[model samples]
Target: MSESKSAKSGGTAGSRAGGTEGAATSARIGVLKTYKLFVGGKFPRSESGRVYEVTDSKGNWLANPPLASRKDARDAVVAARKAVGGWSGATAYNRGQILYRIAEMLEGRREQFIGEVAAGEGLSRAKAAGRVDAAVDRWVWYAGWADKIAQVAGGANPVAGPFFNLSSPEPTGVVAVLAPRRCSFLGLVSVLAPVIVTGNTAVLVPSEERPLPALSLSEVLATSDLPGGVVNVLSGRASELGTPLAAHQDVNAIDLAGAGPELARDLEIAAADNLKRVVRPAPDREPDWRGDPGTARMLPFLETKTVWHPVGS
Candidate 1:
């Protein structure tokens, strides 16, 4: 009878311990991450204090990204303009190192980016992993081009006169890039890397529907030795932000990769007001982000300057 009583007591204690463990597990809560805009090398809430719902391709609630206003767009321009001189004046080799560093940092965070990309674009984990890998490789490719673009794009020109004429490429100051709406991560990297790799600071608008991956990239940029304001990412309606950016006199050029036909038409007209260089989108179809990027995107943001010197001098 005593043994029977002791066994009952032991069973009761075990049951009580199991219940406590379950309660503790139930009490644990997850910490949610807050998304914000990346401007001037800092993460800031939108000046307008507005946010819009972001959903995955399946329309599942993801998170609310900042709804950048005209004021926010202007602020990003200010930040990009401020960074232009310093970033543009850096040696090509130094820029290459920084670009390479971004790739290194991105590789370290590969799994995180893969998850974000998968959710944002509604892709399988394997496909998203491929996109993330491509994005990292793109950065490394541009890094190699940083110090060598000048060699391929510029050189001494043969002249009949007794003077030497040399032409070289220079950054076009601040550029506004509309990141592609599809292939969110890879496409964003494709448009963004070329703009900044060549010394131009950028005000970028990520794919509106799939902006989480892009916002996450801002964190990578912050830690990758890239100067703040060198690449300002505004997560919001492209139409709202692109309007002010297109009309801003200080923005030296605009890439319409992410803009729709109607919006692209309007932005092109607005960009004409200040004679800004424009990279117009293809009228029919978007270029395959997975294909060879070539130098076409980089050329639009570069200006050629010719210098003449007497042969004797």
Candidate 2:
């Protein structure tokens, strides 16, 4: 009788454990997210009506980011051009305020970025958070430069002809930037903040394989008091969009930080059609975006206009 009772008790315990395990396994699955492109301060589906699956470093499906086409790149350039006069001509103080606002928005959304970075790079949560923090800090660094870069890059030139010669740096107009393939967020911000902080408008091509953080960042920018069309971001194949942007007469410059040697060489050749200033990465490698980005990044996108006035009337 005692054996019979013990067997019943054991069976009951096993059944309870199984039920608990089944309940734990039944937790709801999360809804996946869809990432779109950001252009002219708005989120829009790619005109091509196509999206490419973005996967984690482990090859797990993450999200589908829009695959921007040449038409998208052209539209981005048009938007950038429309924003140039106002954005580039805005007072330095105003530009600084807008850049600081981007940092502010980023701070509020840090946790989301931390998660995205961790998944994209297969990094530990702590390391990913550190990267996110660094990206925000980079924006802060560039914010301070907005009002100061002109002073450091331009000044008076001594002239012998009884005239005052003044050299001043001005924005180089619309620049198309190819974001680095690795470290999506940090590299993107590093390339982008420097380009726009100096009063230039930009059309940025985010890393094709990992574009979630870049898409999210567009949300922050849209609400961060940055003027519409000042910064347009596209997610797609670099090779497809890059060629048209380089050849386009409207684009004033090209940043080849993410480009390989072959593509960079081809784009550089095409950019020559309009005599566009080209910023190429080191041979056979992407730029070390994590390293110090000195004034070199800013200098190429600026034009030095020297003005002279007769001293004696």
Best by the lDDT measure: 1
lDDT of 2 by residue, 151-252 (tens): 899998898898999988999999999988887899889999999999999999988877778888998999999999998999999999999999999999
RMSD of each: 9.4, 9.4
lDDT of each: 0.87, 0.85
Error of 1 at 112 (Å): 1.0
Question: Which lDDT value does model 2 have at 279?
Answer: 96
In candidate 2, stretches whose alpha carbon ends up further than 4 angstroms from where it belongs are 1-31
Clashing pairs in 1: 41-228
Model 1 C-alpha RMSD vs. true structure (Å) is 9.4
Instruction: Evaluate residue 174 in candidate 1 and report its C-alpha lDDT on the 0 to 100 scale.
Output: 97
lDDT of 1: 0.87
